[model samples]
Target: MSSPRPLNRRHFLRTTSAAAATGYFVGSSSLTRGQESPNERPVFATIGLRNQGWSITSKSTKFADFAAFADVDANVLGENLEKLEKQTGKKADGYSDYRKVLERDDIDAVMIATPDHWHTKISVEAMLAGKDVYCEKPLTLTIDEGKLIERVVKQTGRVFQVGTMQRTESDQRFLKAIALIRDGRIGEIVKVTCGINGATGSPVIPAIDVPEGLDWDKWLGPAAKVPYRALPQMREGYGGGVPLYTNCHYAWRNWYEYSGGQMNDWGAHHVDIATWALGASDSGPNKITPVSYSLPVEYENGYPTVDDQYNSPTKFEIHANMPGDIPLVITSEGDNGILFEGTKGRFFVNRGKLTGKPVEDLESNPLPEGAVEAVYGGPVSENHTANFVAAMASREQPISDVWSHNRMLEICHLANIAIRLGRELNWDPTKREIVGDEQANAFLSRECRKGYEIDM
Candidate 1:
């Protein structure tokens, strides 16, 4: 594939200037030269204002003001509102519904930190409403959602930054290690082992009444209905009653209804890096074969529900066939980390550290001069939020744009589908569909609750 033309700063300036004059609302805030100017700080609202939401909102220093906050739980929203006011000394209105927040013309953008189920709906709607979005990672809950989001983004011509912050941190050893391997420092790549945790056994907890100030039904969104449990306590603030078993808030990652478990949670980060390094951001695996899997044992009532409460495979080995007939096997073992093996040697990387054949070998390895720039073109903004803001101003794609992100997301989704189906599946990247297996294909897109269907 040929390299895309590098976006020029002069052209970006002219485009943004024209867009601003034509009354283009980048997100929630209007572009104005004032205490709240898009040039200085784009006015913004935050949806799902809890946990990672706080961090995403806090990091928007370059191009956003906390103009509005939305959450299904009023308690969480109230706390964040106070925190934002205290820190930024700017008052922001609070709302329980995100639609109300999106309706405001004064806001220029929105930072969505909701669960996997809510990501696509809010993002597509926000884009349609003419707001740039910084949605949290894993992009979407299902493969079909990713494709839908990509289409909406293209159709609306809006800037979208998936919250893959690992892409920002320079010292992110995993990404750096991948960069090293992609440079042929590891010789011809053969296989990759991505380690992630299996789902935890469901905790024993009773369903509790919904909290007074929370909109429990709305929080469930497009996901299937379930009894309310206490929301898991987020590191940032308290959550509504959703329970640790359901992993309703942060732990939602463990359950299938809301998330793709570790395959997507960690895969969204590590597997993404692997794909990025392979320069296969536009496509995904041609086939996914599950080498091994450990499904959660059936349970009764409170002990262990026989029903498949957690849809993800606890332990599984999935082989992803990339271009050139190279097979990348992403396995789950020994907690979480990524291992890249090539003809010459292999290296392992995780949040903690990077280790391999020789430490000095990796340290000395570097990408061919402009290779990194070629992959992530445009001005490299070290800060992820700043990059989104810059992209909004420049009308350029952010580092983690919808297209590349969906490709990575597809890998994880395919892996999950393979494990769930308990068999190997052939994939046609061109068609973006599974071949031959109608049963497997059914998993791609889920039946959205009435009125929540995504128009593709």
Candidate 2:
């Protein structure tokens, strides 16, 4: 398939603005057409059928038809397919390899919930294969990977949505929050604090035999091949039942090899909202300072020294010097939410609630009509996946567009790098590099393990 021209953002905004003026939203009109016809519904395939992979797909079935499911582990791939069939009475094909799903012409889009390391490769390939992509947050493992995904997205003209659902979901609380900020209810912004909860250190886990029906090598993918490690101890709740310390399952978030611990795990969600409210979606932090942090394992030259346990920082208080001299503190402390502090008033918001004086005052002094819709660029969707489907129908970028996601994610990535190196970093957001620090800049991108290099 030949690559098409990228979506014209300026034209889209103008059109949507005029539609909004007339009490009509651009995406909603076209999106309803799909629901009216069975064949018009986009066909979706999920690439990673584990925790979030299943969650997104389950929610997405409201607007799209599932055509296939893929996972490196056959066991996981099969279980999700059964679950999907039970829920929808639609028996879809299952594949252990994601490439097979991407190769199918019937699939119009792919929901990728793979590990951080694999996001860039699969997203690039899927878009190149003529499928629109809805990828999970912390859209990339590293800064350069974000650049690659951005390039592939623009080159392919795909309707890509990063899984920062706060932009669409969260009961419209986040949208209300942004609207308040834009409405100057908070006055001039002074400081913003993101209280993404901290992570816990893991015990030494011994290398164990790969679990039955698991493809260890395929799971490793672009990450360096290593012995599969697990402790047999089971986690208690959500994403539980699997080994609590395995490097291949839900516990992969604890390792730098596969994830960025809570920094990217939770940070991806909160930081994206914080960045959006700060009006810094197109810009980023100029400096990232590691105020204080503690890693579970030793490190040498920013590389983890041990291989048997979690290596990501368990606790961190990173200070990013953002635009307008605003201090954006990403700390593994306080509530798991965002606090927007400004000259006039302050407010806090999370998935569960939006609070503070600004929120309280809203009852007596309600926001201007259509305030929330204005913040969302149009009428809000039923959910995050609905916004993606709307974008699919309108052929426009979704609320969680790749360019803005990457911009916010760069702050999260730089925070990890700062804490890992135990120093402050000078970042040139425009250049997208660590200024004058070759050694630190080297961490911006990782070399893929042999035989797993991404095809450009």
Candidate 3:
């Protein structure tokens, strides 16, 4: 592995001289780069130390040295530090505030595993700090945040990899599927079903006192301040208990305030594959209609009528019409996977299996040489985080770049908005506008808490 360009005080000053104009470090560091000893590897920080954050940090130690850890919940920060230190034989510093971790010059990169809302804030700041980033899936909570991230990436020229690890893992099933579709093995593609099953919401529970050692205000961050609710604040573990319905942590996906439910939860992966097969990563749907939907609670314009219960759509079938003749269906009714149906044949794929006539034909006739490699943009790695570390050294774009993911996420956001409004809406991709419906258009962005506004 290539060593990161170590920044001394002078180098940090030089690289950050343009911070005022660009909002982040723009100049290149002058430190030499070469192989570093095992303990001297590039330093990386973990910003959110809960579920997905813990998983990513644990796996990333093989690629980068741990430098700092941050989380709003002090309990998580303390526990994870001991576990990581015991494994690596070195103490990785811990912090409750993420901005403090970003302020350090020696830190080379950061992995952002915060909730959907905090993804944009930490990612933008990390790039500005001249640090490469690995952010969890559903890159943004809203469509406008996606636009902001795309612009910041272009300005900073930092390496970024979304946590859609299916590209690097999955034993090439999704890649092969994309290659088959692109190579015309599926004939003329007419329709697709990206099935991401949904779930119900937490019930109307009374607010409880903030848990001991947790920073409730910082945990809310850009989200609105509500009385602390235990079920939505933490998961089954870490002083939280299981509820009759879904709870937080794993079930944060069930809430609209913190996430996009199943739409962004699983759609970040499958919808991306659907977009890839159609060669539409840089484009999006021309129109969207909510054929059917069932939210956990009543909604006005788009806000939930009640705060005590989960409110995101729990069951939905959204129709997205593309520039091409094909129409994409997103639903919670089918097996959890993606189905590509063309005039000639159809195939199904998920994490466990890939099936249908197309896959069966692979026995007699296979994808040509380098077909899978072509789809992956190059040689595939053993896992996804390795791909990100490789891109940091090569200074090349990872397989899942922000621009394409942003485009795919736009589709997911539109579907969610369509479901929320209970109406069909027209979209102009070129102009990035929702045609004719001002109320639907207003759903594209949101009101961030005043102090936490996206400055970019």
Candidate 4:
């Protein structure tokens, strides 16, 4: 199997046409043509320097020079800045506010991995500042935020890549899956099941003093003002040393205020690939039925009655009546991956494995050469950030463009609405609204806090 060659940053920075841009990839620390020339490197700054934020920046350092790092937590910003200095042998600036990083004229782009609530605000501002964007997925907290972002991308013509890396990485497993479906190896895709795994509900966390070096209000930008909350428990994996039960840090995923829980977290990944494979990225579901779900807290009128505990659903099985009448099942049960069942055969694919009869048949009845590339729209970039830079060079949206991402995310967002309201939702994809249910329709857009609203 052939892989993409490491791209020269210079070519990507200088190229203007798609054909010239398509040949290059990203993620090479050493310049092949001119090792000492600083002009060959694109300058970058990262916002939200937590786990995923640092992850993207780490990958990007190979192709872009780090100008600064920003985070609501001073500690995170300082730590990442120090790490970047050590890794690149160059000191970069650190800022508590992302706006400082945006103000720099030398920076070429910004990578946003902030919590779900803050994504749209930062992304919109970044594009308006003439910076291309590579934002983390489950990109919007609500459907309307996605629309706002789409508008900005169109108005600015800035390259935008959502952090749905499955389209590029995962060893091209997802790309191959899409190619298989197109190859008719799966015949007519009957259903695509995305098992994004459920999150554990949190116990009541009492209000506590905000940690020193962390700007609590800035961290909660665009989100409602709330008391800082945490339990004494400490998480111990990636992004560890943080409290395991809090509406901050790693635990923020469990709250409706900051995130969409497991649905948006993992659904952003697997469901995205499923939707791509199903060829439903341009359109959305006609209805969303919450087959079953369990929320950790009680709710009143779709709002959590209590705010101290994790309020996002703990488990769910949502069925979306998608375009072409395809049934897209996003559920918490089963293995953590996508299962594509079709008229002729079936297969299952996750980060680590792609199995079942169809995948097994590939050895004897292989897909055509360049199949993955066709699904990817071009040669895949070395990584997602590389894809973003390549897109910047070509002035084209990358494989994970916002338009397709929002179409699939509409299903996930509607599923949460269905679960919260304890009823099915009839959707009109063209109108982009909930049919007839005014109350559910209200969930499509959230009101941003007064001081943190996006500027156009």
Best candidate (score: lDDT) = 2
lDDT of 2 at 426: 97
TM-score of each: 0.86, 0.93, 0.89, 0.92
| 262-326: candidate 2 lDDT, tens digit per residue | 99999999999999998899999899999999999999999898899899888889999999999
Better of 2 and 4 by lDDT: 2
Query: lDDT of candidate 1 vs native?
Result: 0.73
Which 10-residue span in candidate 1 carries the lowest summed lDDT? 1-10
In candidate 4, where is summed lDDT lowest over 10 consecutive residues? Answer: 1-10
Clashes of 2: 0
Candidate 2 regions off by >4 Å? 1-39
Q: What lDDT does candidate 2 reach at residue 247?
A: 89
Top candidate on TM-score is: 2
RMSD of each candidate?
5.1, 3.9, 7.1, 5.3
lDDT (tens digit, per residue) of candidate 1 on 1-456: 011212453454345445545433343234322233333557788999777898878777444678899998888899999999888888999998899988887777899999888999999999888788989988898888887887787776777889887776646455567567757767888877777676654544346777688786787788767776543442333543345455356656767778888888878988888887777887878888888977675522212343335545677778888987777777777757777888888887777777876446644754567454444442345568766776676556667778888898898898887777678889999999999989888888887777666533
Candidate 1 segments exceeding 4 Å error? 1-39, 170-175, 230-243, 297-311, 357-359, 362-375, 454-456
Of candidates 4 and 3, the better by lDDT: 4
Worst 10 residues of 2 by lDDT: 23-32
Q: Which segments of model 4 are wrong by more than 4 Å?
A: 1-39
lDDT of each: 0.73, 0.85, 0.78, 0.84
